[model samples]
Target: MTETTIPKRGVPLWVQIIIWVFIAALLVLVGITLNKRQQGTVQPGDKIPDFTLPLFSGYEYEGKSEVKLSDFQGKVVVLNFWASWCKPCEQEAAELEEAWQFYKPGGQVIFLGADYVDTEPEARAYLKKFGITFANGPDMGTKISQMFRIRGVPETYFIDQTGELYYVKVGPFVSVNEIKSIVDQKLK
Candidate 1:
C-alpha cells in the first residue's frame, strides 16, 4: 500500500495576530464597563446610599458600636473619605474635628470619617495625633469609597436632613466655619 501525505491545515500568521488583537480589545471593553459600574455616579439631590461599617476609631454613638449612615437619617450627615498617609487629610483633620464638636452637641448633625485604604493601627494613630473624636471607621475592602466614587483623600460629602446628597467637597476644607456654613444651609 502506498502512504499518502496529508496537507497541513494551519491558520495564517496575520489571521492569528488579528484574532489576538480582537480578543484584547474585547477584554479592554469589558474592563471599562466593569470599572464604570464600580465607580457609581452619585450626584446632588440624589438620595445618598446607606452603609453600615464597624468603627475602628473615635466615639461609639448611642451605646452602639457600629456606625450606620441610615442611623443618622433626618439629620445632616458629613461623610468624609480619608487615608492616614494623605497629607491633605491631615490638614483637614482639625477642621473636621472642630465641626464635629460644634454640631455633634446639637444632635442635628453627624460626622463620619471613612478611612480609605489604610491600616487600623496607622489610622488610629492618625486620629489620635489629630485629636479626632468623631466616628471613624476603615472602609473595609474600599466598599464605601467605591460607592462614593472617591478620587482621593480629604473628599467630603454633605447629606441633607432628608438623606439627599447636598454637596461634595473634593479637597481640604478651608476652616471649620466653612463646613459649618454648609451644614447650616442643609439644616435649613
Candidate 2:
C-alpha cells in the first residue's frame, strides 16, 4: 500500500494581507472618531478653565503684564476668543467694545478678549480699528483656545460670578444688546 500525503488548508496570503489592511483602516477610523469626540466646547455649568496670557493691548494686571483668568474670579466674565484675520471677529469687534464700555463703570463685569492665532501688529491694528478699549491679550501658542476647545474665531464664553461657565456663543455676537442681555442676567 502507498501512503498518500495530505495538504494542510490555510488562508491564502492575499486574503491575509487584505484582512490586515481592513483592520488598519478600521483602527484609523475609530481613532479619528475618538479624537473628534474628545475635543469640544465648554458647556454651561462647567467650570471655566484657568489660563494666563501676556497682555497684548490692555491695562496691566496689578503690576504684572500677564493676564490670568483666575484674577477675574467672583466677577461676571465675558471671555471672547477672536482672531484678527476672521471677518466675523471684525464684525463683532465694535459690539464687544460697546459692551465693554457699558459695563466698565459698574465694575461688576470683566470683558477679556483672547486674541487667538494672530500676530502682535495685526492684532493691535484690529483692536485699534475697532477702538476696542477692553483688556485684550494674545492667546500665545493657542493654549487658551485649546483649553476652551474653540471651534472657530469670535467664540465667546460667559462665566458667572461663581467662576462657572453659564453660556456660550459660538459665533460673533449679534449686537451689544445681546451681550448686555447675557451679562446683565448673569450679573443678577
- The Cα local distance difference test for each model comes to 0.86, 0.85
Q: Which digits, one per residue and each the tens of the lDDT, describe model 2 over residues 76-150?
A: 999899888999888899999999888988988988888888888988888888898778788888988888888
- Judge candidate 1 at residue 4 and give its lDDT: 93
Report each candidate's C-alpha RMSD, comma-separated, in the order given: 5.7, 4.6
Provide backbone clash counts, one per model: 0, 0
Instruction: State the lDDT at 116 in candidate 2.
Output: 86
> What's the TM-score of each model vs. the native?
0.79, 0.79
Give the alpha carbon lDDT tens digit for every residue of 141-177 in model 1: 8998888887888899999887899899999999988
Residue ranges of candidate 2 with Cα displaced over 4 Å: 1-39, 57-59
TM-score of 2: 0.79
* Model 1 lowest lDDT segment of ten: 56-65
